[model samples]
Target chain A: MSASVALSVEGLAFSYGGKKALDDVNFKIRSGECTLLLGPNGAGKSTLFSLITRLYDTRDGRIELCGFDVKQQTRKALANLGIVFQQTTLDMDLTVLQNLRYHAALHGMGGKFANQRIQEELERLRLYERRNEKVRQLNGGHKRRVEIARALLHKPSLLLLDEPTVGLDMPSRQAIVEYVHQLASSKQLAVLWASHLIDEVYPDDHVIVLHKGQVKANGTVDEVLKATHTGQIKDAFYSLTQGEHA
Target chain B: MNIIHFWRALWGIVGRELWRFVTQRERFISALVRPLVWLFVFAAGFRAALGLAIMPPYETYILYEVYITPGLCGMIQLFNGMQSSLSMVYDREMGSMRILLVCPLPRWFLLLSKLLAGTGVSVLQVYVFLGIAWFYDIQAPWQGYLWLLPALVLSGLMLGALGLLLSSFIKQLENFAGVMNFVIFPMFFMSTALYPLWKLKESSALLHNLAQYNPFSQAVELLRFALYAQFNQSAFIYVFVAFIAFMAVAVIGYNPSKGMMIKKAGV
Candidate 1:
């Protein structure tokens, strides 16, 4: 509940039937800082995201979003966070503007203010020209942008992106990377950017390496890299998680 | 969930559902065309073959066409339930199901909102279809319009909940044609949609009891009663029980922790 921490997780656990998916995971993301969840496929990152976002109920451990318990004070907690799912959440049939307008209305913003917010968000995302375009017409990166715009409509203090840059071209990936960095800076927002793409993490940003449902390493990139004793992250990440020791 | 935010979230889900229906014109046709064919071609051919008896809520002699209106309303609901389930299968395949699963609203509210919206579209189609029936001399008492709203709401909820339940288990679209053959046709034919259950019993005791227990029969009877400037309490009870049961199952069937959402989340 400290002012510096936007999200805090302790000992999270989840299982599918009898098999464990996420086990004893722990991490904290702070204001103006972005935390990258680094793990390969089947490393339980998505399961972790589902638990943090309250998509899946958890029996073990605790998650606090912006000082509110996710399970107990769920509405207040959820209200303070905006999430971008790894999948495309936009309605393919809806125009960009219509989608954001509908999102604002769901938060019960008055129609006039919702309209104003819609205009502002679309403009901020550089998507005004495509406001009338249905999601079906947009490319993968553009659709990702729409999801980002949709997430920000309610003005959340903490943003959770589950692989926001997946499938994007290099420029689009860089654009998203830059945008999340800037957003966290400008708003003092805390971000959890979950992905296996090692390139997205900068040395100074907090990094948490999850392997087999546990936090194997967590600190600023340099600290974790130095602990793994590999000069480069890609090498350190592979050395840390691969060859049966992870 | 906050009450107002919850309600607003429901509206957003409904709006998105309606948008999906609009963009998929093929789905719209699939919902309406089969029912219209049954009303116009199939019902017209059987109007004489299906004898009219002491139908409840009907005090005097009436045409077979007039007697079938309530059953047809139930038919619209039945078709909508199955149709919505089919689209849910599509939603699962396309991955947007995750989006809905992760919404801030309570899960039950989200599911109910979908039922209400799909039912709204079904009821709207029913009115247009009813207008067609009217031009052909199949219309009911003009007084019936007064009680139509509640009737439509109940019928829509019943069928839509049933659809939600079905959608949660159905693993793929290819499995749906089997539902149409085994589930929809049997439910429609056994219910009093085209014949009175008393008469259907004359053929088989088991079928008779099944028809009486058939929730669709209750839905039809309720609509039939309302359309005749009356309300049937027994019929309402039937619908109430069916709605609660189906919705309970629907809620459990799609829950993210243990229900079908986890399996579907194979993503």
Candidate 2:
């Protein structure tokens, strides 16, 4: 419950029918930091994202974004939260400007202020040149940039991306990862970057390793490596998720 | 939420609906074409076989095309309602709906705004069909056009609510065609859209009773009466009540706790 914590979850639990999807999980992402939620496929990453975004109600635990409880203060909490879902959400037929404007409108930004912010964010993403182009015409990297730009239009304090780089080529993937890291540092925005790829993690970055609906490990990369008795994160991740053979 | 924000969100959703409607030319042509065919082709064929009686709103006999124009208007609204819901299903599966539901507004506000937007589009389609019918020499009183406004709005809201309710239950887009065959076809066929209630009674007592109870029939009746600058109190009551009931269930269907938003967590 520290003031610096931008996103907080305590004892969150979820299930579908007889199967448990998330179990008593707790974690926090502080302002001005990027936390890598690394887990393999089918490891409950998407489910956690769904709950955090309030797309699915939190059945058993509390989730607070910027100190506002998600369920109790849904409006305030969601206003402070921005998300880039794994799937491409841009209207394929709408121009980049139209897509961003629609998103801005959804967040209650309009008129001169919305236009100014749209220009600034698109410029920041180096996507201003293609502002009038339809989203489908943009390359994968540019489309991802547009999504990032749209996510930042309202200036949310916390940003969530669920496997954002899933289908991108290596260059686009690396660029997006780097851009998000820079976004966190420059804007003091807290970020939760979920992915199954180990290479996306850095030694100094915070990491939360989830597997089998449980948070197997959560700390700095070095700490997780130390806890799992491994020399590198790749080894630590495999050992923690697949059992200890290292 | 601030009042300005609420208005902005509503405008945004409605604008998006308009944008999509304009971009999909095929949808526009088809929406108009379906009812136009019923008015010109089907009514022409049935005009010989059916005889008109002195109904309450009409003192003299009317052509079959003239009689069914209002009903055809109702059909356009009904189809537009279902088409909007179809897009909603596509949005949900494609992840854009997730973006929409995450807005800071109340869920009911968001849903109601969406329904209103769809209703607005459907209303526009109804007017277009009426204009086309006017060109074909089937006309109502000019004042009836004004009276028809509220009737069209009410019918659109009622049918859109039905579509919203169906969208909540339809999990996948592939199953939507089945919903059309089951819900749309039955509702359209079983109603008095094709024939008067008296005519239906002559055909089958059960059909007369069923048509009397059908909400779609009531909506068409309301529209038919309003086209002559008159009102059917019973039809109005029936449509109002059905609108309330369908809307309540549709709102509940979009509730995050009960709606399609929730997915079974990956085991």
Candidate 3:
């Protein structure tokens, strides 16, 4: 409910028929914080993201974005959300600028303002030079950058990324990790980055480890480490999701 | 939402579809070729075998090609509708649909915008087909050409909504070919696209009734009358009502909470 709280999920649960995909999940992401959602395969990471983004409606509990209930105030809540889905959503034939402009327009931005925002995001992602290139022509890393740029076009309050670095090379992955962390602080953005990659976690980042549709641990890096009694995040994550395969 | 936002989003969606249509030369060619082939080849072959009576829209006996011109226009819209459905399925599978759905606007508005965009593209294709038919010596009254625009828009929206409904039911791209075979062919052939209701009665009473009641038949009749500078009131009402019904169901089908997205989320 606080102004800084960009995303809050309370007693959230979702199921596929009888099988629960998410169970009583609770978390709040404040502005200027990067929350790493650590979950193994089938650990409800995508389901949580889907619910938060309103891709799948919440039936069992509540979700709010920027103090607006996603269900009751969907338009306002969603207006504050920018998502980079796990898969590449860009049109392969469209140029990077075209794709970003489309996103801007969808968010109800137009003319000089929309163009200016597109340029700013593209430039910040170091993709301004290749703005005219077709998305298909870009390397995997560059395409991901464009997706990132597109997500940021509307200046959303909370950015949801669902395993965005899965297929990228190490350097690209590293660059994105750094860029997102810096972006969170610089822009006062709230970011919920879902990943199974423990190495992507930063020392200052908040950590929420999920397993089997439940939150196993949620705290700051130090708090989670202290609670789990582990020396490192890799060990902490393995211990939290002990039975699941990485 | 503000009107400006709604307008921009509509423009963005329509512009994207137009860009895609313009860039894809093969799609444009195929859209025209299908109707043209029916006009040039099928109508040519059937002209001697079938004769037309003095229908309301036709004051005198008309050639097979002339009789079938409006039907071919309906065919273009129908095929274009299904093509839009195919692309919707493709976009969903490729993950692009999520981007469109996540826009802050109402879901119904988003779906309607998409419907309108597809209808716009189909209208463009219909005009192109009509232009080519004009060259083939099939011409409508100048005012009728203008009148056909609204009819095409209505018919296109109805067919496109039907396509959108089918896309929601279609779970995978691999299943779409079967749906096209099951849906497009029957709707086209069972209707008056190739023959009149009276002609169908000569073949079978059941076919006559079915063709008489088919929504596609009404759409064709609407186009046929409009192309001749006359209005078919019953056909207009039928097509308009069908468009509303189809659009309602398509909107519901795409609803995230109650519809296909739930099934999709099961993954």
TM-score of each: 0.93, 0.97, 0.98
**CA lDDT of A106 in candidate 2?**
85
Q: How good is model 3 by TM-score?
A: 0.98
Candidate 1 lDDT, tens digit per residue, B1-267?
457777677777687777777778887777678667777787789877877766568877787777777788788888887888888888767766655655566678778888888988888777877777888887677888668768889988998898899898888889899889988999998898888887888899999999999888889888988887898999898898889999998898887566776665552
**Candidate 2, B1-267: lDDT as tens digits:** 689898898999999888888898998898898898888889999999899987868879999998888889889988888988898889989999888999899888888888889999988888888898899999899999999999999989999889988888788999999988998888988898888888888889998898889999999999999999999999999999999999888877777777555532212
Encode model 1's per-residue lDDT on A76-154: one tens digit a residue: 7877878898878777788888778777756656667777877787787799888998888999988998888888888
lDDT, model 1, position B239: 95
**Per-residue alpha-carbon lDDT of candidate 2 for residues A1-246, written as tens digits (9 for 90 to 100):** 788899999999988878888899999999888999988776788889888888888889999999999988999999998899888999999999989888888888868999999999998888898899999999888888899999999999999998889889999999998999998989999999997787888666899999989999999988998899999898898888895221
The candidate with the higher DockQ, 1 or 3, is 3
Model 1 residue B215 lDDT score:
87
Find the 10 residues in a row with the least total lDDT in model 1 chain B: B95-104
RMSD of 3: 1.1
Off by over 4 Å in 3: none
Error of 1 at A204 (Å): 2.4
Candidate 1: stretches off by over 4 Å: A243-246, B1-3, B19-24, B171-178, B255-267
